[model samples]
Target: MALFLLICLVLTARLWSQDDPWDVASLRAIEDSATYAQQVGRADQIGFSLGQQPFIANVLIWDQEGTLLYPTSDGFTPIRYELTALRIKEIETSRASAERPFWAPFDHRATKLLTCLHEANICLIYRRAELEQELGLESDALAKVTEPDRTALLAVMSLAVVITGAALLWGLRPARPAPAAFELIADQFIARRGDLTVELTARDVAILDVLMKRDGAVVTKDDLYNVGWGRDFMPNSRALDQHMINLRQKLDPDKSRPHLIHTVRGIGYRLEV
Candidate 1:
């Protein structure tokens, strides 16, 4: 289940990364509106129309020579702001070359708008922030995902988190319960719990016998070492630890808490059962 959600999340993020065509359509709408305004000589009114749009911070038109045409010197300084520059060069070039009806030159402002929109001579600029805010993007300056797409992406991420948590919980589930009764049959070198019985080596029997005799009392490692293997043949420090581990595994294979033997840090061991 977690793997499935992970795959879904990947696909969702991939799909959301694609550009929405509506952004292009919206820009075209603005272009078309500008074209109409220039044709009818309402060029000065273009700013008013643009200002009405929630996404338009400002509009600027620059000629091929980099000279500011619209929003003349009296309106704004020529310093460029962070902008989305849309170069209509080739597009305008092809359209301008097409045949047209005979007419006189346009009004000064209309000519400026015409030159910006229909000649291969100008670049249109808009504030980048306006475009981002209008399109619901925070960082990626281009390509936008709609509100629904954003919500779906968030939901996919949430599901991925939930699936991961469930996996962890399953891994941390409780250990199996220990048996009801347990005893060490020293004579037979065996450890028994209910119906289960485990055979033990002679050394394991000697160590366990010592722990049981001092039940609920901490038995020093030195005493256990001497008892299990006479002082003349004492093994390495790690030998005793390894033997104890093996004994614990044989006695309670389930390895539940509140074990029969407890290590008293640096001191020694204690027998609880």
Candidate 2:
């Protein structure tokens, strides 16, 4: 019962953490209105082309001189005092927006971004609700989710987050045993695998050294060839392959399961010990 209550509490907390759909709808409406306003501004030269054209009919367009451009239906009613309200909303939005677009993202100062045709210094205002339809928005701004649906959503999302975090932590955790460490002493070379040691020829050690430096990453044919032979590598040279074969034979005691000096078919070789 306690676990069930705890889960319910977590679910409730998560739901609370989400932005209200109404708020999201309002922001989306504003952004869409701004985009459409920009398009309309580009269409007309005098800044007001094709009737009293504003893509979002609910929006109020204003000029730099604090004159209302669209909704000429109202004649010339300059609402400059509304600038204080718009400025306040702008400051709040800029403050609330997070760095990531996915989480709690709002627009850059709505007032600043909504302003189009700066030559005319025209700006726009979008209200939350409009009974009429829009190009890319729902008929209503309110998104109503049932209680059961919200519960299901919260459960699924919580599980997904937990799974993703676990996967990342597991991937980043330290690898076991680590890569085999190699050392050369006179004629012979030695590689240590925890408690055990594998011995090889000096030439084999030289080839292995290149692969070790790469830290389990595949070493190119050219690199292996060059390191194995003194001069520049040639496509025909099989010297590197011969040495690697000898190294692999010596390293793998079972000879069935290859764990060190892997041949990558056509490309190159990789070491795993």
Candidate 3:
């Protein structure tokens, strides 16, 4: 399950990286602006609309005969020459339509879109950034860019479903059944549930036997001492406690919370299962 999620994550990243960052919506917006500029004709309206779009760097207006009407200055001389050359070529060929917009390379950072208005008898030029900013507005731009990557979207959704399913399966899994019983065989203590066993000292075995016989009932300290030391060689309370500590540690290293042997406070200890 983990491996599948990892594979999906890697595949999703690859698909996302392969997606195109540019969208046609940006081009459509630019085309509409250029068409409107040519229809308005007034320099003020055209300039105002152009100024509103931060993506547009400059504009050029050309008459039907390919004469530069706007930007009287020689600043865009190279671009003007290219536009006229293309216009003249189109005119000579008589193949290109005047109603639709034409695309031409501007430079490394920008491109030029020429939209010719047949009724107005003039062509509107727009020098726009390669990545148009008008339509690239955070979430809206991301949605437009990723909408075409259906494969990547599907991979992400599948990963979410798999993770949810794994969590559900884990939560619904059956609990492990507790050990049925325990028995002492020589120096080894064994649980009936499985082959789980632990080696024990003679005193540890005797002390455990007494507790096991009483089951969950408390076995007193005197009883444990008699069984562990046989009265004649009985040790002090601290010694018996130290032996019990060692026994509990051997049974379960986490003596702070012993599962098999539980301390019964003041009295003695009891065996649970």
Candidate 4:
């Protein structure tokens, strides 16, 4: 899950970096094309310089209200939308015609940019960012990653996953023969190690099973919740701790050498074999 989030953040950053050139171009486009002196209270563009710049696209500026400061030709209507932090907003792009592609409510990823025209109410909207996978990079990087590099990256990731899985499996390999005379009589819900005997409930057995399966390592609270309740862990719940305290008292009636079921501070409990 951490790895997944890291990958997502990296992907998001790369996508954001692609907008550097386009942002400058679009903002310049907005600034130069301003008909209102030094900026007024509405969204408008002054330039007729479309199809000229490589980075800039069909620029359209609008105020908080969806009124087009610069009128648009071809079937394009400004639908009311609330502007927030997300750079891209889904807007409807449809014609009044009943043709195959010119139907109603065609969703387009609109790039709504906050320009310096006003107190930041004026915004320049475009469908520029969704043009490609990685915006300004080489096309071959997206389609074909030069074979060798792609193969190497995949190989490293696979090796990492395999090593991680093996380490976890080796560490969590369950202690066999019932933790040295701490015998669990499953049918009776009773555990016995020498003179000490601990009676367990079904839930206690489930939780202990999960902990014992980890050999001697600390069993996480979340993992215990998963095995014990068959549900996600709730942070507010103290049931696991209470159960472990009771089980520990039963397991260590005399509290002899090498503590059984020792709490690892913020983590869960660990048992000595």
Most accurate candidate by TM-score: 1
Q: Judging by TM-score, tell me the better candidate of 3 and 4.
A: 4
Q: Write the per-residue lDDT of candidate 4 for residues 1-273, one digit (tens) a residue.
A: 323433443344344333334323323323433422233322222232322221232333444464444323323322222222222222111111111111011111122121222222233332233222224433222221111223333232211122232233234333333333566676788888776777889987887776677654557677788888776556545787787878878787776623456564444565545
TM-score against native, each model: 0.34, 0.32, 0.31, 0.33
Which stretch of 10 consecutive residues in model 1 shows the poorest summed lDDT? 101-110
- lDDT digits (tens) for residues 1-273 of candidate 2: 323433444445445444544333333433444443454334332223212322322234444454545434333322211233444334223222312111111122121122122222223433212212333446443322212225454343221122232233234333444344444343457765544567766667778788877654557788876777645546554766776666776665655442666664445776644
Q: How big is the positional error of residue 157 in model 3, measured in Å on the Cα after superposition?
A: 57
Instruction: Give the total clashing residue pairs for model 2.
Output: 0
Off by over 4 Å in 1: 1-179, 256-258
Locate the minimum summed-lDDT window of 10 residues in model 4. 96-105
Tell me the TM-score of model 3. 0.31
Query: If both were scored by TM-score, which would come out higher, candidate 1 or candidate 3?
Result: 1
- After best superposition, candidate 3 residue 22: deviation in angstroms? 78
What lDDT does model 2 reach? 0.41
- What number of clashing residue pairs does each candidate have, in the order they appear? 0, 0, 0, 2
For candidate 3, write residues 185-248 as lDDT tens digits.
Answer: 7545432323445677777778878887774555778888899888886558898889887776
Residue 229 lDDT, candidate 2, scale 0-100: 69
lDDT of 1 at 141: 42
Off by over 4 Å in 4: 1-180, 232-237
Candidate 1 lDDT for residue 103 = 14
